[model samples]
Target chain A: MRMPKLTAFLMATAVFASALVASADEVHVLNWKGYGADEPWAIAAFEKATGNKVVNDFFNSEQEMLTKLRTNPGLYDVVMINAAFNDQAMAEKLIQPIDVSKIPNYADISADKAGSPMLARDGKVYGVPWVWGLTALAINEKAFETPPTSIAEMWNEAHKGRVTIRDDAVEAVQFGAIATGQNINDIKDMEAVKAKLTSLMPQIKTFWSSENDWNQMVASNQIDIGTYWSGSADRAKTHFKLPVSLVIPREGAVAWLDAFSIPVGAKNVAGAEAFINTMIDPKFYVEWVTKVGAPVSANAKAVAALPEDAFNRKVMGDPGVAKRIQFQAPISDAQREAYLALWQELKVNVK
Target chain B: MAGQVATGARSGLRSALPLLVPAYLWLTVAIFMPLSAMVFFSFMTELPLSGKAWSFTLDNYATFFAQGLYRTLLLASLKLGLEVTLWCVVIGYPAAYVLAKVFRGRSREAIFLLVILPFWSNGLVRIFSWAMVLREGGILDTALNAVLPFKINIDLMYSYPAVIIGLVHSYVPYMVLTCYLTLQAIDDSLIEAGRSLGASRLQMLKRVIIPLSMPGLVAGAALIFVPVVGSFMEPRILGGRTGTFYGTIIEDQFVAVFNWPLGAALSFILLAVVLVILALASPVLKRAA
Candidate 1:
């Protein structure tokens, strides 16, 4: 009994010393929902690859993420935000720049977009590209006998009571601006946005906050057609037997990209960079896209490496479609305020 | 004799002090401090000349009231609240009675549990589940087309009805519990006496139960009405872009607009409006009393 006790004590001491010597790291990643699969397998793979724990948090809107950060700084280590808000965050010293030399996997991003003037500002690097796509109106094939082709057709009387719109202020106003031949970048007054929404509101069945609304609308055939992200069509198609088409309006569409940025006061900067690089790794990149069920910003190598069927999915059809999708730059503060004020009025007065 | 009476009074005061301390502390810590901060901040604005630091301003209030949009939302929110409260009362009263009176013991508990089962999950989860059911390819349509070979455009995901239904579902459990406690506490003899007087079933329920349950009903109504007026999630989630309630306006000022002053001023205005409503309703409540 004494000999057995001594052996057990020695084993316990050895294990304790090993644990003390083991390197441990944690990376706090903030992004949208469906980015990380809330499964043990996914987390374990990430942890095993780079001895770090990733803490995932989700935000509903670009405003929501920035609102929390502005109200309280240093709360998040890394936050995924839009290009428009990131400018504000950088100006406020709320977030820091990613060291370009540290991110070798960024080279894997497509050649066409590698040097695009859209990603940088004032010779400094800020945002890393996340989502690459155009906003298109998703047509519910079952709801309409003849699918609405022209952007103006969404306002047609035939689909009056059974149409839905998203709650985004910029998309609705920008899309309407395009149709009206108004320069979207140069809108001054709130009146124009209100005018656009007031016209659009009468025909809308509802306004959706999330992509779930689009998925449900197309699947259920409740609203005939709706403005949605290109990725939404792909998700809707998987769930619904109906052939959902991306209607790129002649008027033009609001392009969007979500990006990852480290906060200026990030404690685990090295670990955060490591996690980002790992995410861009080909196998992990494919897994995230496959599981996420969305389009990607990864260059040809990553896309080429994907399984044949997954790679050839209709979501990423033409590379040129991406260029047509404009990015949201930092609009003047006055214009941003005008847009929001107009959006609020449209909410109340819309019949 | 004077000293004896004074000591007795002091002891009485001392004994009651512990019980009341918590209530005061609860309100002070949870409600008063935060509200005071918000009130303070409402007057505070970032003056560009002074940099990012907040400065005193009434521009927030001026902006809120100057526009008709802000006030309109308050009215819409109140309307939505009142409408939902009425539905909750109508639906909750019978459901509570069936669980409390018709069903007894474990079965009663089971029925009550079933009503509360959604609460155990999450309000958001249930709303999304409804979205799945009511959407074009939702379970309802799937089940419907299976039975009847037909198609219909019944997308109920992002309309006014969605918010209403979601709000009522979230609050109906509270209504049921309040009504249940009120009904259960009633003297059976009063009900029996009504029956003895040769009153019909509906008459006894109308005369005895409703009047007796009025206090709980009134309290529950007030509880639901106040929060329902401030409901932000339901409008954003269910109403989508198709429809909106007043909560969205409040959210706009603070989040999207970054106009905290205006949001706070608008909130105060809304408070006054609700108080006015409750004040006006007091007469009806007194009559019920």
Candidate 2:
């Protein structure tokens, strides 16, 4: 009798375990930490709604993201890629085109963001546009009585030793291109960009590499003005109560779009699509932007749902600001290497 | 007799092979294999794993030689390594002497722990702490202003000196620990004899104590100089705009530019430079030993 009872219990446990495994599919997501896909609350909501469990991995840089995708094939079900890198991912065959019909919310993406050349190859959409933001000038509210309107303020002799910029090669070159009244994506005059950046070096107090570093510098009064991300500026101002205000100068700012892509050979394509769709849902976007600061949503309906005074809307809502924005484009590997070499050379010569 | 000796040696080797296998296997997997792979990759045109076109090429190495920037940065890193090692010796030698010769029993143990306390925390945290003390409105500036009659700005953040200070703080413990081991092993009677023979304190330190501890000093210098020469974090965190170095440039090649071949060549070049430096120092090290 005791043996029979034990057998019955063992069989029951096996059945329950199999039931649990069959009902929930685990989706592995690779993204930047704190990005929408990784937020605990969003993950919980997705799991509850779709019976799909979300697991997250994070990368610090877009290059690192690509490295992970290349090296760990089939390990990640979903990856968040900057649109500028989507072409490279497709060329490497690391990510697959998403079937937009599977993602109901994909249609809600803003028309401009939907038509991004980087996200699609030929006709199929390889990436689902998620968020967009600007790398623009942010100033200490206390330092500027009237907000500066020109990118040239960074090089003004009066602000010498009080200015800063990011330490990325691509961003720095794009910034220099803008300052020289050239297109960020297609600058014809390399020498002019080089000369303009070199002249700005004396005015630079230092270079910041991360959002945390930028905030620390501002909080300690280390720098009064610097190039910073629009979303991060909102967080610094509203969440941390930092005295910073993001400004889109007349010369324009560099715009970047991030997207969610399903990696080729992903085991759980259905689960990955569900996760992406849920992330773009207006309900989720509104909650994410209102509670935790984020880049402007790519879903037009989600943007409309945001409060009238939302930080993203106030700064990015103006159509004129959109006209002035220069979206980053795919840069060839050789061009990127040249930019890196030039940036390194410039940094080495800094006194 | 020679045949018998050879047979005996062969038997000894056969017996020892089993005991040596694990260690050799570990070394092959951990050190030799990775190094061989890097050397192989350094000669390639592109990373084979990237599914890109590839070929054997010397362009990576050629780029390093053709560009004067790499050479300049390498020299700067060597200079930084030398300066930091010197500061470590200056600050650490005295403290090590006190721990080895002056303090006794429990006091010695307590003070020794204090010397190595910095290692308990993360290197990044320690560097950040120095930033707190060295920044313009930091603790040092506040304390100085309170005492001094005139106002003075003491901003050291993002400066070369700040980098030097942070590095010394992080590595001085190595000098102290190594020197302490050798200094403690020296017989006190030798010092007493030197004193009895009319050698002054300075002369005793220069002639007896230093010579006896030369092995430890050289070891500490080697340990500190190698890592300091390749250091990128402290310089990046502290030196700011002026922080560009050979190490950081190599880091960019691998992470930023995805130029693994160039990064590998650069790394091998740095390894060669370090090996040459060690080879130069071996004569002194052997003499001291």
The candidate that achieves the highest TM-score relative to the unseen native structure: 2
lDDT of each: 0.69, 0.88
Predicted model with the maximum DockQ: 2
Return the interface RMSD of model 2: 13.4
Candidate 1 lDDT: 0.69
Error of 1 at A52 (Å): 5.3
Give one clash count per candidate, in the order shown. Answer: 15, 0
- The regions of model 2 sitting more than 4 angstroms off are A1-24, A71-75, B1-25
**lDDT for each residue of candidate 2 in B174-264, tens digit (9 for 90 to 100):** 9999999999999999999999999999999999999999888999999899989988889888988888888888878876877878988
lDDT of 2: 0.88
The CAPRI classification for model 1 reads as acceptable
Instruction: Name the TM-score of chain A in model 2.
Output: 0.91
